[model samples]
Target chain A: MELSGIAAYLVSFFTFVGIYAILALGLNMQWGFTGQFNIGVAGFFAVGAYTSAILTVPESPWHVGGFGHPFLVGIAGAMVASALLGLLIGWITARLRTDYLAIATIGIAETLRLIIANESWLTNGVRGMSGIDRPFAGVFQTLGLTSAMGTLIVVTTFLVAVYFLVERARQSPWGRVLRAIRENEPAAEAAGKDIGRFRLQAFVAGSAIMGLGGALYAHYFGFLSPEAFMPLYGTFLVWVMLIAGGSGNNKGALLGAVVIWSIWSGSEFFMSAALPDAWSGQSGPLRVILIGVLLQVILISRPQGLLPERAPKTVPFGKVANRKERA
Target chain B: MDLLIDLIQLSIYGIVLGSILTLGAIGVSMIFGILRFAHFAHGDLMTIGAYVGLSFLVFTGAPVWWALPAGMVGAALTALLVDQAVYKHIRRTQPVILLISSFGMALVLRSVVQLVWGPNVYSYTGGIQRPWWFGDIAIVPNHVWILLAAVLIVAALHLFLTRTRMGKAMRAMSDNMDLALVTGIPAERVILITWILGGMLAAGAGVLLGMDSRLTPTMGWNILLPVFAAAILGGIGRPYGAIAGGMIIGLAMEISTLYLEPSYKPAVAFVIMVAVLIVRPQGIFKGTL
Candidate 1:
């Protein structure tokens, strides 16, 4: 490939990686930190994308997109919308087991997808929203770099900020409480922790981040559709990222995001190159199977993940001393 | 009288749908009750079964009823293989991890189906047969076959569980694994039997439902929530509860169309499932949590 071609690929790859990184981070916070299994990641992501798209896009006759606001404002609106949805779902389903949450979230996500598809007045039904504004299109054109590269840089920088923010939260006392509840819910309850409240907080916060990822995605692509936020795209893809990278570790989440996404997007290229024309249609299923097998292998072999959650370095002095005595 | 006829027609349709749900739900509930975790791949297993039946119809030119048993066998073998290859190894992990693993299995199964079936919608037979009139209500042959198959399977399962030695042993293990083990009930044998029964029933449901509607790779996945709802609504681990839950969900979904858009039929089932989960997590029939 030529240098320009290479740059294009890299930029597109990094942009997708950044988008998924944010999403995986959100999920890591929920399932990793708080032990909340949110199977409805797609729902929050869709809410974020559509909310922003509807808020910022110019008015259309068929749909509700008259706000025509600034890009950042739309992004904020997406986050708020997703956060509110998360809060409602979390509050309603907080007391149940992870199994219950899994079903509820899937139901919510699928229902949302249906609504977006059927409720044409709001979402334009199947056609989806277009002409979503990117944040720095003018700057990219001025620099003579492809617009994709500009979005890539912006999205990557945003991803780094999100990573740092999540990392900071992980080290906080609230984070410790979340870990405590995850390790042992009964014990956490006994220690006077309001388990439900903490779970709700994590769920909402995680959902907000996922929504932000959706906004970035919509702005970058300049289009929004319910089909883009299918469970396969939104939920399973992120789950694979977290599980492979090592849940509960922000850096691992990032690494997994880049590696797995490359494999996923890269597989199609490899398959098309390797296979004959007649067999090319089988490539999608082949790649899906590859990922599924990878997931099973990961779960069976390294349930803790590639980079397992790090053991805390600083221990309670008393406990350390007692352990030394025993040794 | 005209309204009554419409109501009767709807009820028949509901029952037909309910029987399919019940068969699928029974498999799911049994897996949870016996094996102690939700089987996410159950829906796809149903799809696999339906596809296997379709294959029989295509290649052998077998009658639709003849395809049912062959499909059930294929699905059963797939379940056994899947259990040996996947679920057996991860049996010791956290239930949540097992759940995730099942999701992977679902992916694998779905992709395999897509690969083999090429993602096209196919019918068992191309032509639509006219429905027979019962007084003023119309009943299709496919619906009758579905209802008949479901009743036969359920009755057979009931007799097997109540009368057969191995079935009773399976029940003992489900009731209390530790005590059953102490009493020398072979755990492996029971587990095998559970998978076979679950597989057979799921396949039966799949084929019959496929007969009623066009078969697609996602037919089972589409109805996944309703099946799960039926299982949970009836009581997750109770076979009879699944049957009752299926009937209720099928009726509710159909009846909901009176007040809701037909497109939102599945949503009605979901709403019912969530409501039941909130009001009674153990299920309406007091299932074990």
Candidate 2:
């Protein structure tokens, strides 16, 4: 392959890494800071992807696209859509136990997949909606940047912007409220923090960020399909990335995305190459098993990922922890 | 008259589905009671049981009914191994962490099913059975077995919970963990039994489900939400209430087909679940949580 080809590949790799990093950051907000479990990351991801795809794609006879709008419009729409979903989930589950949130998230994600698959007028059913274009592809030509590099640059910009915003939130009093709630909901409530409201806000904000990641993926990938947002790729992998990279640490979230995605992609490449054609289908599940076991190992040995969260100084409770690390 | 017939037929189907869901809901409720977390991997355990039963049939040429015990045992072992290997270590931490681990375990179990079973749909029997009918309503032979097994297992569970000392311990643990521990119940032994019972019930649900329909890698996962809905409706940690929840949810899901497309059954479940969460988070029964 030419040097340009290698450059394009690396750019594409970084582009994906950046997109997933944004998602991990969003999850960090909900799970890491607030301790609100959301297993339905894929639901929000799909909503964002489809919302963006429908807004930006050319109108079609089959599905609910063909608006042919700008990429940024799609991205905004994606975030809004996902935020709405988050708001609903947060409003409902915020008042309930964390487990209800988890169950409800799974339910909502499954329902979304069903709608995307069954509602032909909305998502073209199973055939899928395609023809999504990158953000300002033609304008990047003047910059002497290939479409891949342009995507990489745009994704990086989003990642950095999100990182700053998330980091800023962490340092803010609002972030402190969230951390307080996660550490001890009863204490936070006693301290006059509206646990429900803060939780709803964090959940919605995190969901919006996930939606942004989904929109970026849509614009760069230029296609929309249900298969693209399986829980394995959309939800589980993001959770793994967040936890492994060290939950609550934005930098760790980013690092985990780059590291885990590389391993995931690399393993896929090897499995495809090494396995005979007859056993091709088995590799996917084998990889899943491997990842599952890896999560178990991480939980047992290193519950705090590679980058342990630099938790702000706060009082801790022993309700859920026997080994509390005071920061 | 036709409408009435349709309702009756649908109700019959609902009862069959309800019976199967009850088996799963029982495990979920009991696990929640004893373990203090929603077992997300439960559906996958069902899948594991279904495939294990399939293996029994293929390897030993046993009757389909025999696969029931074989699958229950297989699922029981799987659950035990998972708990011992992963969940036990995390028990000292938060139950929420266990929940996350269970989610991962769900995926792992599903993938393992896919690997061992080759991702192809399987059936206990290829030959179609004639429906046992009365008037306009028809009951499939397989459904009879499902209902029978469900009733028997539930009865046995009722007895175990009330009569046996171990069963009392299990219930005691669910009723009040701290008090039960203070009363000198061996928490570890209770936890072990809980996994075995939960695993067996989950497998029973899975095998019966396969008997009713076709067995696929995702068979258990597909119904997990509905099962959750049932468990929630009955109250999270109340086993007997789960039975009532299962019956109601199963009936509602099937009867809704009268006005909805079959594909929308899951959405119906979701709607009911959300409604319950909004209106009465404690569920129909007083939830231990």
Candidate 3:
């Protein structure tokens, strides 16, 4: 590959990693920080992506689109839309067993996918929505930055912002309460922390971050489709990333995203190059099996993850900040 | 008159579907009761059963009904294998970890099915069976066989639970783990039995579901939520309650076509599950052991 080609490839790859990293961090807040198991990451992702696509895209007869808002507005709209979905799911499943959230989330995701496919006027059905221009097309053109470069920059900005925000949340007393709930729920409840409320808050916050990732994805790809947000891509991959990188740690979430995505996308190239032409269709599932087995191996061999969560040095609600918090 | 006929017709269809859901939900209920985790891979287990049955049907060239036992055996062995290979290793960990692992297992099973079956739709028989007419109401021959098989299975299950010592032991374990352990119940044996039972019934459900509809790689996964709704509505851990839940969900989804779009069938199940969760969180049976 040429130098520019390699750079462009790297840019697109990192852009995807940045988006997935956002999702992983969001999940880290829920599962890693609070021990809420969510299997419906795709639902919130699709909602955010469709919300942004419909909001920012130009008028279209195929679907509901007339606003043609700015990219920031679309991204913000995506966040709000996904956050509301998060709130509904979190509220309903918070007081129940941890598994209830898993089932409920998957249900909502499946139902949402069905609705997207069936509701033709809303999301253009299975035919999908296209022409979702990259963020700030005019400015990027003037700046002489490639579209991929511009998207990577935007995704990186969001990734960094989300990382900083979640890290801050992880250090706050609020995060401590969440961790307390995860470690020992009865203890946290006895301490006068409303367990249900804290869980809901963490869930909603994570969902909003997933939404932001979805919006960035919509703009970066310049297309929107229900298939784009399958549970495999939107939810399962995020879970694998967080678990592989380090669930409780924010930096681990980022590292997992980049590393796993490379493995994922890298496998695609490998399969295409290695497999015979006649067996092309089988490769998709073959790749999935490889990754699926990888997940099982990781779970069995090193459930603690590549970067196991570091114990917070400062005691819960302690006034003195631990110097290691900066790490 | 037409509306009554429509209702009755839909009810018949519902009964057939209810039979399938009942078989599937029983396994889910048992697994959740005994294992203390929602078996996310149960749906894919159903798929494996259906495809296994398909393979049997292809090999034996017998009536499709004969495929049932073959599917049951295949699924039971698969379940035993899966439990031993994957779930057993993580059994000591939190139930939530099992849940995550099962989710991965669901996808893995599905992908493996696709690789083996080639993702195209298949049916047991090439030509459709003529529907039996009962005063303008239509019923297929396969539906009758499915209903009869379900009845026999349920009856056998009831006897096994009430008569057999092992069955009673299984019930006792689901009811109270500590007490069962104190009573010297072999936890491992009971757990393995639960997997076998769950797998057999899941396959039974899968094969019946295939008869009711066409078989696709995602056929079982598609109905996963509805099966869950049936289990949850009946009470998550109670097998008997799952029966009632299955019938209700099946009828509700079918009859709903009277007013709602057919595509919203799964939504009907979701709405019912959510409503049950909100209104009667313990389920109608209170999810008792």
Candidate 4:
């Protein structure tokens, strides 16, 4: 279309990239650092989006929003709700085996979707909630900030803040405990660590971050729909991101999200543009095939991902012994 | 009296559904018992079996009874091929890696089904008329057949496990692979046989499920949660326990619809599964995991 139109699309794409990066980082913390194979990130994401939308949407019956408060307050509320839900689910399922944990998470995610789809009173059912006012609309209008620029500023600021927080958490003693639990749960337990509690903490913290991403997404779009939280879109894509990224590394998570999402978005564009008339109608199935193929190829070629986690270096025991002997 | 009748009707439907679940659970339990990893692709295998049955019915214009065997055979062959191609290759890998691979396989199989079936629902029997009777306690003829087939399959499985040489080898492998190999049981051959048996059971379950409900590309996907729930609830590695667990879950899901919304049936299973994991992680039946 026009130059401005293309620029607008690019801006929106970057905003999405930032939001997904946040989601990937949160998932990386849970699965990579904590060794909790949670396949349910989408459920918490839906909870966050729906929570913010239900609260802030105009003329809703379920506890009116803080008088159409700013987006930050809604985001904070979504994070708290998501974190509490994560805590509850994690407490129950964290102690189970990895496969059981995966199943439980999947079940919870699906059930959450069902509730959102069917609970008409709270979420407006399948009709979803709309008319959510964007943050700083008046300011943007007065200050001459475009919609694209406004979204970019808000999303980028949040992304940078979350990145720093995740980095700090990874360097802290808590992060060490989480890593220890991941590497050897029994040993960590023997070292007087409550494995379940640490895992639950990581899970909740990560889920809260994911919830923050969801709230940002809702506000950016100015609408909320249960369809947006379908398991395939939300859960599978997050798993793909975590797996494609070196799971334990924050940088890897960011890179993977940007790369995979670009591929996904690019494929949609390419398929719709290039397919012959006869086969163009089947582009949806073709897109799914492409994703499935990519997942298999990635898993087989480098299960540890492109930038696998590096082992921490330690002084050799023999060298240490020799030095002590010489001294 | 009305409540009693409703309960009985629900129980009957539960038993029919439970029978299909039992068959699928048997395969899953055996795979876990022998392979020592949860095979997530088993659900897709059921879908594959249903599709195979549909193909047979369409091509051969065969009776549903004949199509059932064709489906079972097709499924057994597919399982054997999958085992040779994927599972055997990853047999030496870490259990977690194998688990992840199974998830990949599940995705691939589901995609293939979607590609072939075009995301539409299919039925092999073409909506057979139910023979209703007994004053609001109606019974479908297909349901009776499914129940009968389930009993026969269980009986046959029990006999095979108890009385046959391959069955003994299967048990021996499940118990200790190294010991079985040392005893000259041909571990690879026995494992192949176990997969074949598991595939047959899965196919049987798939066809029966298709008879009960329409076979959408997502039919197996929908039942996967319950199947896993049954397997975990019964004890992951115990075939008999899986059977009982399937029955319990089936009954629980059906009965819950009486008090709760029908959409919440799977959630009820999930809650029970989580409760089971917390309260008795080892499951009600004892199996060597």
Candidate 5:
């Protein structure tokens, strides 16, 4: 590939990075902030994608002529639907032990995939739905910009906004409570926190963000399939990103998404390009092996990840007063 | 009369399936009981065991009976090696870390198997002639053998657990690891023994399952969920509870298929597990880690 082609590939890669970053931020809030291990993120993502696709697909019983609604509205719908589903699932499984919770969430994710696969009317079944409209296509056409460029622009903007919001949330009192819950659920409970409610709140809110990311992904890809939302893809990648990047830090999440996604895409590209024809068929299995080895290395070497969460520095009241007086 | 026979036949199949599940679940439950965490790799371990049996069958060209013992021995050794290599180092880490490590191990095992065996289904038994039966229903010889094996395994396990010194030590360690260690029960040896036994049983189950149906790389993936469900339903650490739970889950799953789509069979066990967890979080057997 030429330099421009490589650059274009980079653009597509970073677009995925931005989208997954948003999703990982949500997961960080749930797992890192609130200590709720949700393995069913792909389910919520699928729900969001299917919701937006079904609502906006032309000639559907659920709605008419795609409603010609703005892409932003579809994103909003995805978030809302995902949040509702999250609330239901979180309420049911939140109180279970960590391992059981993981199992339950995995089950829910698999079940969601199965439903999407079997329900032909809603998701077009295994055939999948296509022809999703890209946002700002008209503006891009007028500017003579490529659709990928337009998508990159919109997705980056959304990601930035999401990052800002998550950062603000991290600094807020609500964020403190979530951290408290993560650190010691019993302590939080003794401190008059409604553990279940707070967990549900965090889970639902984070899942909504994941849903929004899914909606963005659907529009960019112009297609939605049950296969696109496999548990391995959704759960494992999110985990890799969160763990590889510092879990609690939004910046780490973003960096992790970009870095890990690049490794993944680059490896696949190199394997296909460099390997002999006979060995080419083995690439997929090789990729899985690579990821497994990488995960083991990460787990053994740095459980806290590359850019681990930093403890907040405590400032003395006397120092604050002295500084204020000087100012 | 015909309906009664069909029900009996269904129950028999369910019991056989339950036996396989019980064996697998016991391995998982024992690991969880001693290790204080769920090992997601147990299902894949079952797959490993099945593959071991298949390899034995192919290499020695042994009868199915001879292959069974060889497979069990292979499985026991593999479990010991896996423990020494991957699990022993990280056993002291946080439960979640160990759990995640198990996932990595599962992936490695599954991938290695796929690379070696390819993704296609393999038959462990070269076609057995079906035994002719009385009445409207004809019971396959393999099914009867599976059920008999399950009963014998369970009986042997019960006696071994109750009668043997090593088995007593395992129980003591499971009940209280630190206490068992302090009492000079050699907790490490006990754990090794547990893994060996668990591995043997899991391998036996896998071989039986392969005999009943085709063995594929993903064979264990489908069974993993139900086995976990059975383990949880039976109570995490209790062997007898796992057996009972397996039977219930197997019956529920198979019988439910009569009413619902076959694809939904896996979900039945999951639903039952969740419901049991919600109702009695400690599981039906009332043990806690």
Candidate 6:
């Protein structure tokens, strides 16, 4: 590959990784901290993508648009839309078990996809929505920087900002309460913590982050499609990344995103190069199988994940002394 | 009279579709009743069964009826293998982790099916069968067969649960696992029975559904939401409830298309599911979670 070609490829690759990291981080908040099983991450992502696409894209024959609105307006709209959806679903299934939420969320995700695919007036159906602008595309081009490189810079900076915010929340008193509720719901409830309320908060916040990631992805790609947000590629892949990277830790989520995306994209390159023409058609399914097997192996061997959550170092000495005395 | 005929025709369509959904719902509800966690791969297991039926029809040159049974057997074995290889070990972990494992298993099952059958849609037979008229309404022979098969299976399941010792033991296990174990019900035996029955019924549902329409790689997975809605609407552990729930879901979905777009049919099932969950979390039949 040529120098610029490699740089562009790397930029595109990192941009995707950065986008997925945001998704994984959001999932970590829901599943890891709140013990809320949200298997429908793609639904929130799509909501963000479509909301922004509609907001920023030019007017078309089918659906209403924001008439080429500013990029910030699109991003904010995406987050709000996704967050509202999250809150609605969260409130409805809040009292149910984690498994119920999982099933409901999956149903929600599938329904969202169906609506997006079928509702031509809103989503333009199968033809998809295109021609959205990247942030500062004109300025970056004038400065002789490639659009890919510029997008990567934007995405990374956005990712860093999100990471810092989530990390701060993870260390806060509210974060402690989330862990408390996750570890022992009864105890948290007994301590006067409104478990459902806190859970809904986590769910909403996480979904908003995912929505932001979707907005970034739509702007960076300069296109949006229902096909781009299929659960197989969108939701399940994020789960695999979160699980492999260690669910509870923020850094693990980022590392998992990078590592898993590398293996995922790398295998495609390897398979294309290694397989003969006849065998190349099966490459997509083969990659899926590999990830599936990897998930199984990881679950069986390292259920704590590669980077398990660290224990909080704030236990009272008096409680330890009391236990020691009783023993 | 014309409207009545249309309504009846829609009901027939609903019943045929419901039979398939009922079979799947029964399998899923049975597993949840006994195993105490959702098997996320259950839909893909159905997919595996449908694909197996297609293979038997294509490779072995078997008749559709015989191929359906062969598919059931194949799916039953696959379910047993999944139990032994994955679920059994994961049972030691939390139920949530077990649920995640099932998701992984779904991925594996789907990919394997895609690898073996490829992604294109296939059918059991080449030519479409003409519908048999029932007075003013019409139904396909496959629909009749599907309804018959569902009735027979549900009757057999009832007899097994009510009359047979193993069936009663399975019921006892579902009612109270600790008490059942203390009363000398072999947990392994009950678990084994659950997987076998669940697998058989799921396979039957898959093949029947395939026979009705065309078989796609995503046939089972796509139908999952409806099956789940059925299972939940019927009450989680009640087989009879699943039957009723399936019919309700099927009828609602089809009938709603009369007023709404055909594309929004699946959404009808979802809306019903959410409403049921909100109003009566225990389900219409009042089965425990």
TM-score leader: 3
Q: How accurate locally is residue A5 in candidate 2, as Cα lDDT from 0 to 100?
A: 84
RMSD of each: 3.4, 4.6, 2.4, 3.7, 3.0, 3.5
- TM-scores of the models, in the order given: 0.95, 0.96, 0.97, 0.92, 0.92, 0.96
Residues A80-131, candidate 2, lDDT per residue (tens digit)? 9999999998998878889999999999999999999889899887888888
Candidate 3's docking class is: medium
lDDT of each: 0.88, 0.92, 0.91, 0.82, 0.81, 0.89
Per DockQ, what order, best first?
2, 6, 1, 3, 5, 4
Residue A232's C-alpha lDDT in candidate 5? 63
Off by over 4 Å in 1: A139-146, A315-327, B1-3
Q: Model 1 reproduces what portion of true contacts?
A: 0.67
Best prediction by DockQ: 2
Point out where model 3 deviates above 4 Å. Answer: A315-327
Interface RMSD in angstroms for candidate 6: 1.0
B1-289: candidate 3 lDDT, tens digit per residue = 9999999999999999998999999999999989999999999999999999999889889888877899999999999998999999999999889999999999999998998888899998888899999888999999999999998988888899889999999999989999999999999999999999999999999999998888998988989999999999999899999999999999999999999889889989998998887788778798952
For each candidate, report its DockQ versus the true two-chain complex. Answer: 0.71, 0.79, 0.71, 0.50, 0.54, 0.75
Candidate 5 chain B, run of 10 with poorest lDDT = B124-133
Residue-wise C-alpha lDDT for candidate 6, range B184-209, written one tens digit per residue: 99898899999999999989899888
lDDT of 2 by residue, B1-289 (tens): 9989989888888998998899999999999999889999999999999889999999999888988999999999999999999999999999999998999999999998888878788999998999987876788988888999999999999999999999999998898899999999999999999999999999999999999999999889889999999999999899998999999989899999999889888788889999999999999998976
What is the Å distance of residue B234 in model 1 from its true position? Answer: 0.9
Backbone clash total for model 1 is 0
* Residue-level lDDT for B163 in candidate 3: 100
Model 2 chain A: lowest-lDDT 10 consecutive positions: A318-327
Poorest lDDT segment (10 consecutive residues) of candidate 6 chain A: A308-317
* lDDT tens digits, residue span B1-289, model 5: 8667777777777888898899888888888877777777777777788888888878888887665677689778878887887678767777777787776667666776787778889886667667668677778888888888888888998999889998888787778888888989976787788789888887887888888788888777668888988988898888789998999998888777667776777788888987887788668897553
- Write the number of the candidate with greater DockQ, choosing between 1 and 6: 6
Q: Give the alpha carbon lDDT tens digit for every residue of B124-212 in model 1.
A: 88899899987777889989988999999999999999999998887777777788999999877788889999999989988988989
Docking class of 2: medium
What is the C-alpha local distance difference test score of candidate 2?
0.92
